[model samples]
Target: MLSLLTDQQALPEPVGPLTMFGPDFPFAYDDWLAHPAGLGRLPEHVLGTEVAVIGGGLSGLVTAHELMKLGLRPVVYEADQLGGRMRSASFEGHPGTVAEMGAMRFPPSATALGHYLDLLGLSTAPFPNPLSPLTPGTVVDLNGESHWARTSAELPTAYREVADAWEKALHEHAELSMMNAAIRRRDVAGIKAIWNRLVPKLDDVSFYGFLSSSPSFASFRHREIFGQVGFGTGGWDTDFPNSMLEILRVVYTGADDDHQRILGGCQQLPLGLWDYSPGRMAHWPEGTSLASLHDGGHRPAVTAIDRVGTGFLVHDKEGVAREYPAAVFAAQNWMLLSKIRCSESLLPGPVWTAVERTHYMGSSKLFVLTDRPFWRDIDPATGRELMSMTLTDRMPRGVYLFDDGPDEPGVMCLSYTWNDDSLKFAALPADERLEVVLGSLAAIYPGVDIRSHVIAPPVTITWENEPYFMGAFKANLPGHYRYQRRLYTHFKQDGHASGHRGFFLAGDDISWTAGFAEGAVTTALNAVWGVLTHLGGTTAAGNPGPGDVFDQIAPVELPED
Candidate 1:
């Protein structure tokens, strides 16, 4: 019998200082690059460049790649390593398999991303189909008793409510196509109007509250399952906080098979980007800082750009400094606010405060590598396949699943989720935490001897503690939906005006498809187009028109009950 563990009290407290990034974390990539040579000489020459991109993550990288294609030399600056939030780790003991500690799964409607994969010559396979109702997979309650929900259709009423919301959210806010009307005409006012009407609804109310309050939302018996599955407000806090209508717009616009994992790992995409860059665009000399205005009117902007005059000056954790005429402010909104010394104060008081106070939920993933296929037991009565399980808690909603091992059959991956409190629990000593997790797992699956089967120390990535990324992803606060209009609108306005003339903003936070990889790529493409148009490039015209693309794809068809 397979059971799921669903008690927080049983879990051990997390150990160590909450590893969050602050002003002290290195902001300039050159700092780390120069550490080997002990040479920290900053650049002083004016190297004319059309644009400077910051943050080597998908957004920055894709933007740079597009710029390069447009015949412009766009320099990229990464504060730490590439692949911003999409970081993966391979344990020493577990050689072939890898675990994603950061971003996971991509949505289907990401056409540009598909193009990116094609560019790198990477082929994708369908995600492993989840277990069907015939399998007796367990769903644990707060008391540690487990009950099985046969299929997603058989989920408890509460679970259904949340799932309904998820399905609704997906169809509503799936892609950028919904915003085509405003984007194509650059109708800032129209977008703002739509945003102003939506922000107030997201304040304070958790996802649970939204469903419960909605007249159209049907109630369910296992409402708590929503939290367990990480769907509702606290469970799955997305970057976009607009009204349900706007959120639904995103869901309906994007592709259906959007949720997919890369065959090798997320790292392959970035490494491929680095490898593909031409000699002129790829590697830069170590310890050589891009020129700044202070040296000779040749300021090279760092990741979070603040202001620019004769040259460019960007301020990040590295302190307020100037760079050459080109710079990229790739840091998050809060980070950008901290570094950039804006003369006009592009961000308003309320918006700035919201950005500062917004609390992002915490998340962590554990990849377990085994020498052999562990779960091969057959259920005599149902004969259904079981690949994963979901555990519920009174407080934190934790989800875990077994993924195909990278190189071999026996290899597997496990992932977990926790809110702020659960994250605090994760701070306990490793042994203690391990014991608690294993204890929980043992309760769910009495057959496996977890203590004896351990092959490697688990690798954990705490998004809450990451300096550059303050939290896993953005979530809608109580009233954030109302402010979202102003937030996105002003973000674009302030981003462009920050410095470097045509510098624009792109990322998960800014896009309507927030909290997904598709959002990141969509925004990056938009920012690139903006940059190209500013640079007098005609590539935008050469690219397939959004309308043409939209017309080619058939509309989604929902199944009948």
Candidate 2:
């Protein structure tokens, strides 16, 4: 969800100070990371021990970095480049200007991820969301008509009606205000109370089902418009089939609000952490960093994994095989079923089934550099910017304008689409995609010549087509709560047999809130806690890790039967 057409009067009563503290498993990962006591202390013998970390993405990096701080030597194996989906592709000869092929906007509620961003000293600017205060203007093109507006109030009454319907539906069925208050206050009891009651009732309900069941959304036209231009981000009709619980998790925690973009690029977070030297660490010497541990680079892709005796044996592409007492698979979960070879004994039957059942959304983004901020030019007749952030029903779906300065090359995301909309452009080459996007935009801005300002070749990515990442991110379907829980809690392997105990899972897909980076960070921390506990480590007194508090604040579980 990336575009929002929110009407201030139509919105629910305001709630303040929200963070991504779970509506499922409510744990303060930010507080845990900030604790001076440190994550945990490994046994003396476990100190300096090698822990194999598969995948060099944000989750993998966070897992490896924390493992290093806990006195364990981490060997990171990346099938692709570092930062995974947090990729920032720079145009030729353009340094700061980049095409954010993956993650771009992030909500302030991603407090766990914010911890690392703050640590890395990375700056953020308000992303130009549709109708957001930061945006100069917005254009909504649907049914072959264009409506330009600077704010929600400027839109036609029908748009406001759709927005109001959504707000009313949320308050009517989802208990939006109660959950918002609970999440804002970080009330574990209140969160669990509301979430537990709703989980069983709504686990099988789809986002569309939730809306259709609401009286306010009774009009099919309202639902259609609401899906095209959602409240917080852009259109999310593609997400209609997802579990209502999933949508609730995001809205409850404010994961879709107040979005910001990393000033330079988000990839810097992982790259910076790779080279960051934490002031306090256990067994490693001062100034030790993940980059230094790996000779400033990491091993090639992992080809296979085998449970050899009590430990696991990992084989890399370069024929390098290493053994580790414990390992973390932080890559896309689908990789285990597709790209990598793994022993059946590595995980239990149910956990493997959960992995097989994971559902992912396909996404594609196309970006091109322009000569200048031509969009800022005023249209003499209309007194509006020549171009504005766009949301449409056409093939392009969503278009965003990024202005660096009048003299600097500006960036434009010609298209940002998901699911069926994304699949339409997946097979097309970058040039063809650009042509289609330009064609769509031309219809919206009849007089404007968008392609004339282009300064570089278009760059595009289709996550579903990427060999390493088969899909953009996980999105649970109706009746998938059980499967989601299995993957998320797999890190806590104490209940598992000895063979499955040493192997761990981390990444957004393994989290309750799948698409957000906060999920990636928190899940990696969970794996860190799991690896620590597996190696006879204990959290500092008075600072219990997630595993320590598992029984007290575990995610609500539904009966298998």
Candidate 3:
């Protein structure tokens, strides 16, 4: 009973329960990480060898941590800070109030990521998404009209119709129920059976195109409404041009459901891993950790990579060059095309093509620190909360209010927009962005003066403008599944030439489901296994890694012709 809006209260738990087990490449990554047996082992000679890990993001950190545990030295290269997009920018005066610049919300279905959070002893609370039970109330504004509703049943007939149409379309076209059940039970064969069939059929269909073809969404009005206020989250019209297969991947795995935000910010995950020492390590001492190994710092940005004798030569921005037997490139793959100089022999032809073809979505967010939880105040006339989690078709697109306590300062994400909508705010400064969003909110709450509650200047970020991250996240467009497949499968290097075997790819973009931390963690594990195998290592007996069982659970191959 995974409802379109991801209301956990609406459904009872099944036996196994659904996780982010994947509809494509449905391997039990969570189980793999939780197993008592370690991920894998390395040979004695290669134990202390250095392996260059480009990018100090989540993927690179995970790769480095695991490699360190396996007795290999991981030299991590970073262009910016340690926590890549998991940036939490705090107000100048407010101690704990922070605006999540990137990757704010997460779904419980991301079990692989949860494993690390549990390890780090981090806690999560329900995010205040539109219509989520954790939210006090919600406001829906469309076409210069506003409606206040505490639940989905209270919305107008048109909004309810849009919700129902979306559910029906997913059920009829995407095998929603069957896929969910299969994922819950970890039925690998069942997932492959369904996804393999859908991949070929839906690879060329856009998300917008799918809605147009569905009988339940025949009306242009319903389709437009659905895009403006999407289920699980809000305002996914930005994703309309993406492949239907990409949409299916997200929905099938429940990647957008039951969202939560990490307490003390998600940046702590990588930072914690960096400083944490594994209780059991192969060749390294018990107290040795990634932080101790690096002597409290990492190398600068990697500038170039070239082929050496049975290894690779990596050049950093500081003019330092090091040769290693193997390397893992965990940055945005597009960096390989422009920012970083990668030898033509570093990857296969199809993989380089995939890297060049990867499509990323642009996103922008405007946040401000408020004096207090002013939104919780009730109006005398309407008996409604002064303000609520909002979704609209205006420039703001979505507004989420975060309340720590009644006495503590509150944080407001005044606007969160994506794609073309995001680009509209790209040229605006923080103050201008705040003015535009506040103006939009003023129209919805006529008598309420939201600007008066602000205690500090606004904070904003346009992901497309970041030098390290050219865009927010990857979203495959129609017919780009083939390109995605090539990038994802590059970790299994047996098919590639010897020269391409030493270099591996790992990142959310390299995963089937991008924009989720779970993808980042799972792909990092894949690269760890790849690096282990490259050095003539093997997984512990009875604990097969993703690469060990490659032939059986590999992603389905669609004909290029």
Candidate 4:
């Protein structure tokens, strides 16, 4: 964001703390959620009251963690593992060897996740993104050609042209330069001024349209090349059909850059939260952690949710039914239709539509425990390392290497494909997928024999095919902004009058910034505020949660069709 602020010239510093959401939605949630003072204490009457938390993902875990601090008992239910899409699967025999089938790289700008990360006392290093200076080198494979470079200067003329054009287009077409400045300074008004204009216009336009419309990308070839070899993550063609607003938000928020992976895996953050004892507690006994509260495991998956008097009745897969004054539905929205039976009247028609219409993109990742970081070895003939962090127009869209140590062992993500590319291997067995990936890598690296380095069977994941996660992450399609808005601000609606007051929604799917841990954390905070107020609690005098000032800060809602 700072880079954009000083693109043309520098801006004077603001007088005080910069607020990002402006006065209308005037709350610094990232700060408030992690505030040293806390998100206000619950009333004595509500303390220790049990709240049913569906899905034991990060959202549910964080909600349970925070609510526990304020003296509340959270009964969590998860069908699969503790971490939902934040999963990091370890290799069969190798203890520390792991593959991040879900979220691998996390951004620093996502302060909410950062807060929990800091609390857990975890460490991180820059993810070796393709063509990133953080790594030793990068390999770019495009249209049957390959380029090796430590930076853009070493890449071929076409690759550099595409990269420069994209940067220029972001500044002129997307107003990125100005938006970055506003966001960096925490100038809410300035952000709103730039974002409001882009939101309305960009929400309906496809990313392809935005690029084609840009004069900076004069050549169609450059546009296609730009999509295939994107500057940061690479090949956003799968996302070309998505709204331009989505791309802009990703770039503007730094979600696609300055990424760092958890040292062991991202899963440690949630699992750590479950075990870390807070400074204070409200129920049972002091020094009780979430793991201790549940006796080291989560409850069975929730099977049904129905309105029952002032509270709601929740039935788990084990046929046990319990009632709570309030509940947080932290699972994917699709679960409401497939996995769990939700009462028709639980939410209004618009809210239901938003949930049902929510789009999740498919993704596939193949990880192999390698003998060493052999990709960094120099080849005598080619004058290039045996390989570099690769980005290709081929099926293997992106490849990353996780180097534990020079000699110990390393993990290489052979292929990470999204959307259509992922769906290509939806039905293929792991062995078959490995074969296909090996073939692709062989083509990219002529005689390197990538398979010789593989010490164990490769691990693969196709998110959509997984029953627990129908897709990798939530993505907004073109013309779906209204549906997104409804889900994003569903808590502000008449939850009680609409028969949904006690039932709340929280997850990355329900937030404005879908598919990021930040979204998951932000929405969980929103649910906490909802449950707190519903139970007659209030934020402290100095600190205000989102719900406390929602009327002013609510996202701009487009008129319903």
Q: Candidate 2, overall lDDT? A: 0.90
Each candidate's lDDT (Cα)? Answer: 0.47, 0.90, 0.89, 0.80
TM-score of 3: 0.98
Best by lDDT: 2
Native-referenced Cα lDDT, model 4: 0.80
Tens digits of lDDT, candidate 2, 1-561: 222656444445546478888888999998999998889898898899999999999999999999998999999999899999999999876766898998899999899999999999999999888888889999988888899988888998988888777777777788888887888778899989988989999999999999999888889988988888887878889999999998888887878877999988989998998999998889889999999999998999999999998789999999999999999999999999988899998889999999999999999999999899899999999998999999899988899989877988889998999999999999999999999988888889889998889988888999999999999999999999999999999988888888778899999999998889999999999999999999999998878999999999999889997
TM-score of 1: 0.68
What RMSD does each model have against the real structure?
A: 12.6, 1.7, 1.3, 2.7
User: What are the runs in model 3 whose C-alpha is more than 4 Å off?
Assistant: 1-13
**What's each prediction's TM-score?**
0.68, 0.98, 0.98, 0.95
Ranking by lDDT: 2, 3, 4, 1
Off by over 4 Å in 1: 1-50, 128-143, 153-206, 215-222, 230-258, 277-306, 315-322, 337-359, 379-387, 394-399, 403-415, 490-501, 536-561
Candidates 1 and 3 compared: the better one by lDDT is: 3
Tens-place lDDT digits, model 3, residues 110-220: 999998899889989999888887788999899998988878888888887888888889889899989988998899999999999899999999999999999999999
